[model samples]
Target chain A: MIRAERVTMKFGRVAAVNGVSFEVAPGESVALWGSNGAGKTTLVRCLLGILRARGRIEVGGCDARRRGKALRSLVGYVPQELAFHDDTRLGSAMSFFAGIRRVPVSRARELLDQVELDGHERKRVRDLSGGMKQRLALAVALLADPPLIVLDEPTSNLDAAGRAAVMKSLVALKQRGKTILFASHRPDEVASLADRVLVLKRGRLIEDTRPSLLWPSEAGVLTLRLFVDAERESDAAGVLRGAGHLVNLNGHGLCVAVPGDRKAEPIEVLHRSDIRVRDFQVLADYQPDWSRS
Target chain B: MSSGAVQTAVPLPRPCSAARNVISFARREVRDAVSSRWFVLCTGAFAVLAVGVSFMSLAGSGSSGFAGFGRTTAGLLNMIMLIVPLMALAAGAGSIAGERERGTLLYLLAQPVSRLELLLGKYLGLGIALTGSLCIGFGLSAGVLAAKAGGADAAAMLMLVAFTCLLAWVMLSVGMVVSVVSRKVAVATGVGLFVWLALVFVSDLGLMAGAIVFKLRVQELFIVAMLNPLQAFKMGVIVQMNASLDVLGPAGMYASQTYGRTLPWMLVGVLLAWGVLSLAAAGVLFQRKKSI
Candidate 1:
């Protein structure tokens, strides 16, 4: 678990993170959604006790600023910048981080496997591709199996499939009861993976909402295109409304507003109503303004 | 899990983890220094250059020549003055800057280790690595002297080596100061080399000019020499090697007046001050540096 209370970090005249407060409960996966320079990475750094801030921060119940060592042992951080010592083999780098974390050295191999980078542990960091390097970094961060993991832009450099793979591993981590706070600008990743999202803009928290509760106005709204035989438009609308749907007759066909989850049920009702339903498509229910303005 | 077991599993006390973390950082720094190719190459080059210079001096002076001891000592001392600073600079010029460039410094500092401990560990690791290089270079030089000069005085050679080590420590401290102050490795390296040049060449020239222009007495010259570690080291080794070399003037009064007395202690104080100041500067800078 991680908590921040009124945390504010400044670089001279510029505020990198300003009066932001949030928490990631144990076993919960929270996504930090923001555009570039929105202070997502800065907030993550402040929580890790790497950056000096003006307010309180606690990691796994330890005061991050005062008890940095204890807090560090309980948390793993994967930085956005994937810079590594190129000369060291991946295994040696993992072992070295493991040694510093005072964790079991065997955890290196286990984590390497967990990140699906088993055979390439002996390769130098420079030899790894962008996705492979990100995985290796994830493996290093997981070496201690810390209860909380913070990832900044974990999929920013990956292709679509690579991003999906990394997201899958992160989802697996959440399933294993590890609290995760992942920051990214990718909406699809947040939509697909995050249980709860925190939107930030210009170092300020603008919105925080659960994905299930997003787009309330559009949640139960569906657009339907019905191809009814020449004389059946009135009959189709009557039948659709009788079936508990909001129907509107259009020039092309009958458009109906059905609850997003029950849009398919209306088609079944139309089939029994003697109305010809030629084609239909279900629109995804998502609000573009879920991110901060 | 049982209630008692869950209560007992509350992670170990904070102090234990903090101590372990500091030790871990120190160990990692030591490993990095040892494994660095730049460190290996610079130290190796210093050793080879020392040995080569020593043997060349011996051959030039002839094996059985009476002046072979003096030539070998001077050659070794000169090499130490030049090579030790270069080696120390190369070892430490990027200690903090290189980590920052790699973006790993923030990662390490993010842990519970205090800035003081981080700076201390890095300085200690670099000191150890430079000391190892000094030993190798000085050892090879002494071996060459013994082999080419039909076996020189072991005690005298050791004393010179000890003095050389002291000078190397001073260089290490200077390099650390530059490293912590500069944000880029290139800048740190440039500043370190500049300081080294000033100490080895310009300082002596400036002191000589000051003494000559002012027509100062030998006592003033002695004080100026004492202020410069490189000069003091050169004079100390010269005096240690030949008692009748007339290091001062025709009367050899300055040599007798300065050598084997409070001068060594004063130089020791200078070296200690440099070490403490440089390390303190590094600690302060680290404490203030933004984690980025």
Candidate 2:
């Protein structure tokens, strides 16, 4: 479904993407796991034929350079920075894209309905919350019903519910056998969605493996179980929450959501608040050693 | 629900939706211009100015006791020069740059349409809106004149309308160039205004100052005046009206002697060239620009 050979994008003296090459077969879902400036967006833009790069790219049998319109027609793209004018109606905006994509205008209505945005067609696009806008972007991407779907930072801007909503839409797309390549920093999204994970660092593809193997080593976020003094459990939960972790306080244990590479910070946070951790354990069901250096 | 990152067999969409895509983009530009009140204000201002200037010219020339077509057109031409280009620039200058700031530009570009198609669509839409407003504004004022006194030259009035619309097209091209080059709407608009002032007022003022200071020859003055489209438009009007050379100072008189009756046609040719070249230049510049 997609092929990129030695794609390199240089900006001034620095190469944003340096000699990156990969291919995705039909019916495959690949997740590009990278931090900021890892060249994910640059690489994707090169694939879309929107940026100048030194390489060859082919999507759905269309050459990215000579057949850009055809190549773009074969892929649905969702950008990271999403925007819609306050006065632009959802229906109008969608139909506008439908026309551009050479699909029937009715496709807009169908996709919006598919995304569960049926009743809000008349609502202004900018009036939508973060989740609705993201969904709308997905719908816009899905307009062409392209064989391949590409998204940059799919769930980064969404809340928990928004992320769930986006993933559900992706699941539907996947079940239809559409190849998907998405750049994300969220481990949960990757574990749930990606068949393969491509880890990138400093513009190079450092690792390529199945999600199972990559889960423990390069997960985008981490989950830890903090065992603090019972008297200070509520205070500990509060402290974790105040320190920017999502805390789930239950009888079993206090599970605090910590991002990858920052799992040690939660334990340190509790210690600073005069709380003793009797014994803390990692609660990640898929991989206990995830985020361990 | 299926787990995550699965491929689906979605139906493929057809390709090359260029015609519909261009029309949709143009319609979007029109909607944006109208909704933002730029269209309404320009139309309203032209209407008011047209009526006021026509009546003042009619009353000022009381000896005729009637508003002649030629007299009203002469007054309207001066106003059109001041209004049409400026209004067109205002409508056009913020088009791409303003949308870029609002993130609409990149969103539109992300679609399947080509870059040239997008720019051409915008130019068509903005040109139509500006041209339509000019007709209505001038038409209303013309209607008032015909109703009050009558006997205006129908042919001459129609020619003025045509020329005015063409003039708007010329300025729209200039604005599109500004919009493409500027990163911000304010900068585009500011540059557009500067262009208007330089071409309409400052250029003429500068020429006059140079003429006085250097005591330049008539041939030198005519050559310099020919470089400006505004000067060409004015010369075309003068030639059409068969105005006397005395009022035109040395340049017009010298140009008349050098070119004879073919001078107005040459000036009109220059105006047409201005519109075509500006649009072509805009297309070339915009095609090379990288969208966000």
| TM-score of each candidate structure, all chains considered together | 0.79, 0.84
What is the Cα-based lDDT of residue B63 in candidate 2?
30
lDDT of 1: 0.71
What is candidate 2's lDDT per residue for A1-293, written digit by digit as tens?
89888888888778888888898999999999776788888888888877767888998888887887778888888877567777888898888788787777777777777777789988987689888888888888877777889998877777777787788878777777779999976667887789898877788888888876654435465668878778888889888778755566766567765656667888898889888888878755422212211
**Predicted candidate 1 versus true structure: per-residue lDDT over A130-228, tens digit per residue:** 888887777766666678888898877776666767777777777777788889765556656677988788999988897545423334344556566
| Model 1 regions more than 4 Å off | A213-293, B1-37, B63-67, B212-224, B239-260
CAPRI verdict (incorrect, acceptable, medium, high) for model 1: incorrect
Global Cα RMSD, each model = 9.6, 5.9
Estimate every model's Cα lDDT from 0 to 1.
Answer: 0.71, 0.78
What's the lDDT for candidate 2?
A: 0.78
| All DockQ scores | 0.15, 0.47
| Residue A292 shift from truth in candidate 1, angstroms | 12
- Fraction of native Cα contacts kept in each candidate? 0.29, 0.49
